[model samples]
Target: MVIGRADLHTHTTASDGMQQPRENVRMAKEAGLAAVAITDHDTVEGIAEAMEAGEEFGITVVPGVEISTSAGGRDVHILGYYTNWQSDDWRGRLGSLTEVRDNRNLMIIEKLRSLGIPISLDEVLDEARKQGKDRGTIGRPHMASLLVAKGIVDTMQEAFDRYLAAGAAAYVNPPRLNPFEAVEWIRQAGGTSVIAHPGLYGDDDLVEEIIRSGAEGIEVFHSDHGTDDEVRYERLARQYGLIVTGGSDYHGERQGVVFHGTIGSRTVDAGVLKQLNPASR
Candidate 1:
């Protein structure tokens, strides 16, 4: 089989991404992608819509989710691919995570309010509705859009840089699973767990620990990594015998970075997908 051009990581309205799933797929096809995955942060609500859109656009859609977990008191993201989205295990885990995320978002909102920014949950929800195109989950991107709408920031990056980023005034820590526990959960769900954007985390030892925990892959290529970093991650993946994956980590216009198919880019090889057997999940 021909190895199609694929981006295994991306987002949609289901999480912090700006576009709806259909729009993401349409853009991916226009960008000459043969396949794409809607690995939305902490949610799989958009995966079905993405798959439907991919069928029409002739881009194979991989079901995926970017799970937020904690390790050493820091947040780590794990990308789970090819799991049964509707399974009881998946639902249970997602429900628990959703509660954690919702609580975290509320805390962020309260922090912003205390800072005198005063963004209401209703306002955030309305902003999400405006961008959601009536599908998928609403998230931080929507809140950022509300900030933009209120003239708080010129762009999403500016919003994050000034407030939402770590160490920023509006930043708040969210509850999450530790890396080992996250890997175990993914394995239990019959999915492959991968460390997302290892370069950004800036800890090689942590990456090794994650691999030891049960992570089968590493996102060696990503929009966040520079050329040297990509090479380093590639070398690490090879050294650890890990499956390598890459993607744009597209969040739509909410992020000012390169488009969905534009960064540390390499297509997902067919062999890699074959290795992610759904039957194991």
Candidate 2:
């Protein structure tokens, strides 16, 4: 069997990413990647279009989702691969999560307004629609774009630092699934679950707890992970007999800066894609 390179994490307009689903596939092909995963935040709506583009571009498109979960009062993201995304149950459960996300957005907007930022949810929705398809999920990135456009912030990072990021002034963490529950959800949906960007959580103990809770994989190489993080998680994956994975977590360029990193910037052998599927395991 021949193995190629695969960037197993990316986003599109179906979520907060600036690019369309087909555009991400095109970028992956242009980058010489044999495969890419459309792992949008809390939604698998982009997978259909990406899979179509993959056939046209001769690249493998992994159906994935970056599920937003909260654990120990931290924003922990769980990545699901090869999921039954077409299932009505899966879509309905995701809809509940979206409701939580929508409420969080409104609370953030209210907080920002109280802080005298002069923003509204309608403006954020409009910005989201303008940047991507109207069906895309409206997220903090869209709100940040509006903040920058309104001259409230010079860049998206500034907006995140000031308002969107955890511990920021306008930040809000609504009740959501724990990492363990997310892992089980992925299994119940006939997919594999991996701990995403573990280095960002600032709590290796909780990460280890999740690993012990039956997480099948660990994202050892990510756009934001440093050498130490890579080494640490690689060791953890080995210790726990977990599948090792890597990706760029590409979210597309915003304000002259690429969010996280560009596609194919960090990738692993395409063999990992097979390892990411429950059937293969």
Candidate 3:
């Protein structure tokens, strides 16, 4: 059922998403969503701009962040909603992640150079600036885009396929938070921690462990979810008594969904928002 008007997961140039903070808000309105979260990866820089745009566009902007953590040696994303963005602890936690990101960026560039890729961190940063992604934390995508610009690869996808993807020549595993630590950080900042895109993990045992890790909710509805995936996650939510959260996981064209199209793509029900942002409710 299309029970509510909230997309609790989305991104912007604040991290790796293609759209800007304000642009995503305006698009949320166009997509008929009453609320959208600015859950940029490891950064809250776009939250304020999104809230301001929400005011202008008549959309509710939920302050959120997607923390990248590792589980079973693989990357798992945790979505923190209704956070105290200004809290020192919150800011500090995210800031640390950015440091890790920066270090990883340097390492990745070094690896690329070792592979005779003829790339540099400065060139990647320049490409990111050209794409307006400089204001946010730089990531592998920026490096991939740089490869494209330098004609080292024809597209970001090609860059990933050949060198940057996991197990590729230039791939480097970076330091990241573990699931439990991430959940504790979110709860300490007075935010609800959620498991993002559980379908991608496909590990039922891992789902149970995440709940035990203190995750308050699971992303049961997502633009990437098929019917079976939704059903599976919905059952998991019910089994664990967890709040059912959903979102488009919008990342602009960089992802499968559009900036605004995600509103129509997934349904999270108004009740979930009430639980996530009781103050707003």
Candidate 4:
């Protein structure tokens, strides 16, 4: 494919991202990226459409998923690449994770109500469905959008800062899979697992723990990562013999604000995609 730059992490309407899966591909193509990954939260529903878009745009789409987990009293995300996405078992397990996301959304909505922000789950779903993504994963970003719509928060960042981010008012951590389990799940499903955005976890020790526990790669360059974070994680990747990956973590724009970054803002060489593929590895 003569691949060049590849953004290895991004969300779509299949999760909380404002754009559709095809639209993300189009953006990647417009950004002059050779490849992009659709690592939607707890779901692979966007992969098919993204692949089709890739064909249309002459860009490569790496079928991927971002599995959300809790570890060390913090939210962690595991990115799976080149998974057997069509497997019934893989889809079934992801279905269970979606249930967890569903419960967490409800809990956040209830907490928002307690804080005098009268938002309903149905309202959030309706807003999400505005893009005809009714079956996609519902996340805090979805709820945060509703908060902005209701004038409860001035912006999505404010909504997250005041209510959705960890330790915020509406924040709720339900018992869920840990990073190790997530790694194993990806392995069992014939995919390589990568520790995503380790800088966001704020626990290098635990991030290393996951690396030693079987993560095959580390996201060294992420939209939210600083230069120091990139250097540190790049060093760790070399030390542990793990594949080094990077991505924009793009979630599209909300209220004229880009969530993490634009597509192609942070990317690794497209050659890294081969390392992320289990078969090639």
1-281 per-residue lDDT for model 2 (tens digits): 22799998999998889899999999999999999999998898999999999999999999999999999898999999999999999988888888888999999999999999999888998888878656757889999999999999999999999999999999999998888999999999999999999999999999999999989999999999999999999999999999999999998888789989999999999998778876676
Q: Model-by-model lDDT, in order?
A: 0.79, 0.92, 0.82, 0.92
Model 1 alpha-carbon drift over 4 Å, by segment: 133-136, 255-266, 278-281
Whichever of 1 and 3 has more lDDT, that candidate is 3
Q: For residues 1-281, could you state the per-residue lDDT of candidate 1 as single tens digits?
A: 32667788988777777777888889878877777888987778898888899889887788889988877666788999987887877968887887887888888899888988979988888888776546545566667778889998898777777878777788877657787887888888888888998987868899899998779999987877889988898998899888898888887764455434441154566456766656632
- Report the C-alpha lDDT of model 4 over 38-135, residue by residue, as the tens digit: 99999999999999999999999999999999997899999999989999999999999999999988888888888888889889988788745656
| Local accuracy of candidate 3 as per-residue lDDT tens digits, 56-75 | 98777889999988878677
Window of ten residues with lowest summed lDDT in model 1: 255-264
Please report how far candidate 3 places residue 280 from its true position, in Å. 6.7
* Per-candidate TM-score against the hidden true structure: 0.91, 0.98, 0.92, 0.98
| Candidate 2 local Cα displacement, residue 18, angstroms | 0.7
- Comparing 3 with 4 on TM-score, the higher-scoring candidate is 4
Error of 3 at 149 (Å): 1.7
Off by over 4 Å in 3: 1-4, 254-264, 278-281
